[model samples]
Target: MSTTALIYEGDWVSGTSQLDEKFIGYVESMNRSGGLKVRVTQCDREDAVGTSVEAALAKVRKLPDYTPSAPEELKDLIELSLATHDKEWFDELSARLAAPQAAAEQDEEKRYRFTPYQSRLYRIAE
Candidate 1:
């Protein structure tokens, strides 16, 4: 058995209308798939300012013996979301994800940055 975890921010809406409806549908489909678990935590205005995807990833990396379990497909979805909704942030995230983790971690004091919409998704297979 193995489990994979994905933590990132989400943008449910751009204004009054819903955004990422297709992505939402995909998540619903995953829920119906039985082995997937999704957890979404909405950040308050203040919290959102202080939190970021990089910070989230950095925190996850700092966990004792922690490793990301998200499949390449899921990661691609995230990349797509960033590319569509937040190009600047996506550019930063893409560079970070592509960078070697070992090199990034060497600067232990580096701050993890992310957008306002933070989310975490994971899957367990048995």
Candidate 2:
């Protein structure tokens, strides 16, 4: 799956409103194509930005394993993380994304690296 990271700054309401518009369009297109059903989850900014690493890790540990319904959902997750501009959150997400690729390449004895999606994400996150 391909992911593009977009960076933009504005008042919170306007910025998020624009994101919402694009997200709705994407979801509608997926629905029209009879693609995988997308489930949107909303988190408060405080929860997203203010949670401690330990608390966040604990919450993630308690959650069920993810099973993405479609490739698009993964792309959405990357894009959403980029939009937040939170370094810790972005780093954690990038590490999670790199894990599978690193595992797959371990036999080659090469360093683990970002896929293009993650590279773009890292660029924007910085």
Candidate 3:
């Protein structure tokens, strides 16, 4: 396995074992040795759920972020925020509902700078 993805604590990941067992969860802790402890949120094996499973960094990838579209969806999210007592999330959801186009534009923007593979990204002046 290649260390191509950046792994971090709290990232949602799916860990795969050598035996082909898979566990989905958020990373609880990351070790400098390229292993991590994952608090299993789900697994094919019933007993593994809610247990911490150890795995190598190469076996996991961060889950992509999700953005709910539509006024109804945003409203539903606001309700979830209220239920969870997440005031910051409530505020953000409300703002998104109020200005959905702006939020959509932001979502379309690149999250990070990209450089073409095998190509120089900078120019030198004489």
Candidate 4:
């Protein structure tokens, strides 16, 4: 039976090979004949991260998309982005971490409904 392809370029994946250190990396390229090149990011074997490593499609499991909500988690991701020299990802994580504080300020504004007298006092002066 033919199976649907779930992995693609740039997807984070974990290795399923019988090695001492299981690698986690993003897919760099793929071949139609069940082969792929992964840019190893996190692994015990430090020497293998030089370029890209080859693996069978069946030997890699795609990692699920995740958005970390905790400040510590977001900071960790920001550090990782910096380590990888991914400016776009660094900006994204920084923005994501800052969004909550902005939203909290907006929520406070919404909560303090102004009276007619207070509204006039707070109105823009021409």
The digit string of per-residue lDDT tens for model 4 on 1-126 reads: 112278889898888434545688888888888887888887768887655778778788888897699999999999999999999999999999999989999999988978788767455789
Report the C-alpha lDDT of model 1 over 30-73, residue by residue, as the tens digit. Answer: 22222221122332333332222111121121112323434464
Candidate 1: clashing residue pairs, number: 8
Residue 101 lDDT (model 3) = 74
Model 2: per-residue lDDT, tens digit, 7-74?
11110111121122111101111222222222223333433232111111111111223555344565
Misplaced by over 4 Å in model 2 are 1-72, 110-126
Q: Please report the candidate that would top TM-score against the real structure.
A: 3
What are the RMSD figures for all models against the true structure? 24.8, 22.2, 14.7, 8.0
Give the TM-scores of the predictions, in the order they appear.
0.21, 0.30, 0.63, 0.58
What ranking of all candidate models by lDDT puts the best one first? 4, 3, 2, 1
For TM-score, candidate 1 versus 2, the one ahead is 2
Output the worst ten-in-a-row residue range by lDDT, candidate 3.
Answer: 110-119
Model 4: worst 10 consecutive residues (lDDT sum):
1-10
Candidate 3 — which residues are off by over 4 angstroms? Answer: 1-5, 18-20, 70-73, 101-126
lDDT of each: 0.33, 0.34, 0.80, 0.81
Error of 2 at 66 (Å): 4.8
Question: Candidate 2 at 26: error in angstroms?
Answer: 23
Question: Which candidate model has the greater lDDT, 2 or 4?
Answer: 4
